[model samples]
Each structure stands twice: as C-alpha cells, then as structure tokens.
Target: MPTLHELPGLAGQRLGPTQWREMTQERVNAFADVTEDHNYIHVDPERAKASPFGRTIAHGYLGVALLAPISQQLLAVEDATGVNYGMDRLRFPAPLPVGERFRGTAEVAEVTEIKGGMQVKVTLEIEVDGQERPALVADCLFRYYA
Candidate 1:
C-alpha cells in the first residue's frame, strides 16, 4: 500500500480495481433484516426473478456496503484508528444483480490535515460485471489518526 503522503499526490488518480465476492441472496436477505428493508425486489427471489434485471437484485445500499471490504483491499493502512467521517453525493444509478462479480475504484478527491486527524475524501466508483454504467458512486470521507 502507498503511504498516506503518497495518496495526496495521487488525487484524481484511479486506484486499482478491487473486487468483492458475488453479492448473494442470502447476504441480501441478511442486510434486509439488519436494515429492515424487506422489499420484494431485494428479498423475494421469485418476485425479483420477474423484474427487468431478472433474478433477485441487490439493494442499492448494499452496493455501498461493499465499500469497506473493497477499500480494505485497496488501502493497506498500518493504523488501528480510523473513523468514517461520512460521504457525499452518493448515487446508485444501476442495480447490482445477484451473483454478479463486483469491484470498486477509489480515486483520491481531497485531503486535509486537521487537529484531530487527516481527513481523506475519495470518490468511490463501484461497478459490476464490467458494465458501462457504474452500480454506485459515492464521495466518501474518512478520518485517520496516529
């Protein structure tokens, strides 16, 4: 992993592609339970099978949920203290269908060193199955401190 200092200079640079295991129905159902989003499109495979995408489709938020593991793979930070400062301009343009292999690209957008920590903002572009339209786009903010 590149050092945090190296990251600032890489602003607007697309990080390497980091993939996640295919989003599964079981996982989706689990998220629905956790988030209380039991929408048929996301939970009912039989019903979702009749939708435009066909088969159970993943929840839009689920796309965002994939960020942590993917980001962990991209940034090898040697620190234990990191906090999510929040996100900006998050959008889910397309649905990620179940069983599709997904990946994310993180581009450094901005960084600022504050009294408490370093504020890092990254534009996360997540996609599935090499599709032209990204499944999700989010400007994520995170803070890290030694």
Candidate 2:
C-alpha cells in the first residue's frame, strides 16, 4: 500500500521488473476465444509454423489485457480507490510466442492533481525473456481518489 503523499513523490521513479509469466498456448487460445480474434498466428499452432513467426504467438491485445494482473505483482494500492483512466498509448514491438516468458517494469511518468483525485501516467513495458525488444509498451493512466 502507498500513502497519499507517497504517490506524488513517486513521479519519475522506476518500479519493478516483475516476476516472469509464461505465455502458454492454452492461455493464448482462451484469450482468442473470448475476444473472438481467432487469428491463425495466435490460435493455430500447426498453421502458425508456416507464418513468419514460426510458432503460435499471443495476441497483442492479450498482453494489454494482462496488464492489470501483472501490475499487481509489481505493486498494490490498498489505501485508495483507484480507477482505470485508460491508456495513453500502446505498442507491440515484438511477438510473444507461446511458451515464452515475459515480465513487466513500470516507471511513473507523470502525476497530476485532478478534481477529486490524482491522475498518474505509468510508462510500462512487458519484455519477453531473452529478447531485446519488449512485447508490449503502454502508457497507462489511473485515477486514485484520496
């Protein structure tokens, strides 16, 4: 948990390279099913091998969806009511092939006082283990009410 004053002071601070998580085929398939994004490269293992990636890859949006759970492993906000204000930008620089491990790190990009809360922009990166490029990069915003 972070104190009210602590959040403001955290601006420009770097958080963590969180525990790595595997991008399993099953998880990728489930995400594809739920989102109805049945792209062959993401859900069809055998067919994906013929694609440029040479293996089934996770959907770019799936990485975005996992940010909430992954961020929990990096930090917790137990003291305040936090609302997701949505993302500022998102990019997938590399493919996340199934069975690969990835982790996220966050830097507090900016913090501003709002009407009844504070809006914080966190520059987040989800990098695949052993890869130079990150699977996802996003500027996510959150509003925390004191």
Candidate 3:
C-alpha cells in the first residue's frame, strides 16, 4: 500500500496481482438478482451448455464492480476521501467462467495534482486463473481529497 504522501510519486508504478478470488455460482446468482440481468449465459448453466461457452459465465460488470475491493489489497491511502471519477475504457475480452478463480493487477498510469488532492489514473486488469487473456481491463480515474 502506498501512503498519501507517496501517491504523486507513485505514478507509473505497478501494484497488484492481488490474492485470487474464486467466482462461485452463488455470487453470480446474487449479482444477477441485484442487477435483474439474468441472462442465460450468466445464470442458466444448462442452457449455456448449448451455447459457445459450454457453461454459465459471469457478467462483465461484475468484474468491473470487483475492481475497487480487489485494488484495496494493492493500495490503501488513509485520511483521504476517494471518489471514482470514471473509466476511460473498459473491456471484457474473455469470459469469466463460473467456479474459476480470478485476480487483479493495477498500474498507476498517471497522477496529477488537483485542487485539494490528486487525480490518479489507474489501469486495472482482472485475469482468470489458467487463462492467457484478461477477463476485464479498465482505465479508471480516482480523485483523492486530502
């Protein structure tokens, strides 16, 4: 974890590979219920088998939603107010198959001084276990107020 004082100088630093987290069917179903996005490819295993993936997969947004928590393991700045500014680009190039484990890696692309703090641009990557391609990639902006 980097300290608040260290944030500015930490630009271009590579943080993560956080501990792997398994994607379980229960979590996928819960996400589906919350978002009301019970797509067959995401929630119905039997039906998905007939589709290309051969099994149910997780929603892309679920991978995005996990970024903050996953990045927490990579970076922590206390005594600061942080807000998710947004993402410049996001992609789910590969499927996140159910029951597979995934992890995230973060890189501080840029950090610039703002009115009361700094705006950090982070490139976050979520990789599935035993897979060559990342499940998700996002270029995110975060404003941290000191």
Candidate 4:
C-alpha cells in the first residue's frame, strides 16, 4: 500500500487485474434482495433464458458496488483513511452474466490536494473473464485523509 503523501507521484500508475471472482446466482439474488431490484433478468433464470443474454445477469450497480473491495486490492494508503468521494463517469459496456468470472483493474488517474487530505481519481474497470468488453468502467473519486 502506498501512503497518502505518495499519491500525487503515483498518477497514471496501473494496478492489478485482481483475482477472478465468479458471479453466482446466489450472490446476485442477495444483491437484488438488499437493493429491492429483483429484475426478472437478474433473478429469474427461466425468464432470463429467453433474453438475449441467455441467462440471468448481475445488476450493473452490483459491479459498481464491487469497486469497494476491488479497489482495496488495487490501491490503499497505509497511513490514511480513505472514503469514496463520488464517480465522474460510469459505464457498463457488457453484461455480467451470472456464472461468469470477472476481475478488476485500476489506474491512478489524478490526484489533487485538499484540506487535510488528497482527492484521488481512479479509473476502474471490472472485466468479465474471456470477454472482449468490460462489465463496468468508472472514474471513481476518493478522499484520503492523513
């Protein structure tokens, strides 16, 4: 992990395509249950089988939510506490079909000074294993306090 002070110097640094994680039906169902987003394409396998994707798909927001844990593996400030600031941009270029494997990668896009902290913008991508397009791509912001 890099310290908060080192953030500015690490701009443009590319981080890991972390360990693959499977998108299971159980996981999707849990996310749907919590978010009250039980969309048929996400929770109904039989109905989803008739959709273009051929099976249930994970919600796009689920991929966004995953950035929390995924970013931990990619970037961390050893002596600072980090909080999500917001996202400048987000896109789901490909559907994340349940049962598919995915992983995350990040790049330090920018860093700027702020009161008692540094604001960092990271470009994160959640890629489906063996797929040509990423399931999620976002410019995520964070505030790291010393």
Cα displacement (Å) at residue 117, model 3: 0.6
Looking at model 4, which ten-residue stretch has the lowest summed lDDT?
A: 71-80
Order of candidates by lDDT, top first?
4, 3, 2, 1
Residue 96's C-alpha lDDT in candidate 3? 94
* Per-model root-mean-square deviation over C-alphas: 1.8, 1.2, 1.0, 0.7
Clashing pairs in 4: none
| Best candidate (score: lDDT) | 4
- Order of candidate numbers by TM-score, starting with the best: 4, 3, 2, 1
Off by over 4 Å in 2: none
Across 1-146, the per-residue lDDT of candidate 4 in tens digits comes to 88888899989899998999999999999999999999999999999999999999999999999999999888889999999999999999999999999999999999999999999999999999899999999999999998
Candidate 3 lDDT over residue span 49-86, tens digit each: 99899999999999989988976667677767788899
Please tell me which model should have the higher lDDT, number 2 or number 4. Answer: 4
lDDT of each: 0.79, 0.86, 0.89, 0.95
Candidate with the larger lDDT of 1 and 2: 2
Top TM-score hit: 4
- Candidate 3's displacement at residue 77, Å, is 0.9
TM-score of each: 0.89, 0.95, 0.96, 0.98
Q: C-alpha displacement of 40 in model 1, angstroms?
A: 0.9
User: For model 1, how big is the CA root-mean-square deviation?
Assistant: 1.8
Give Cα distance to truth, residue 64, candidate 2, Å.
Answer: 0.4
**Local lDDT at 144 for model 2:** 82
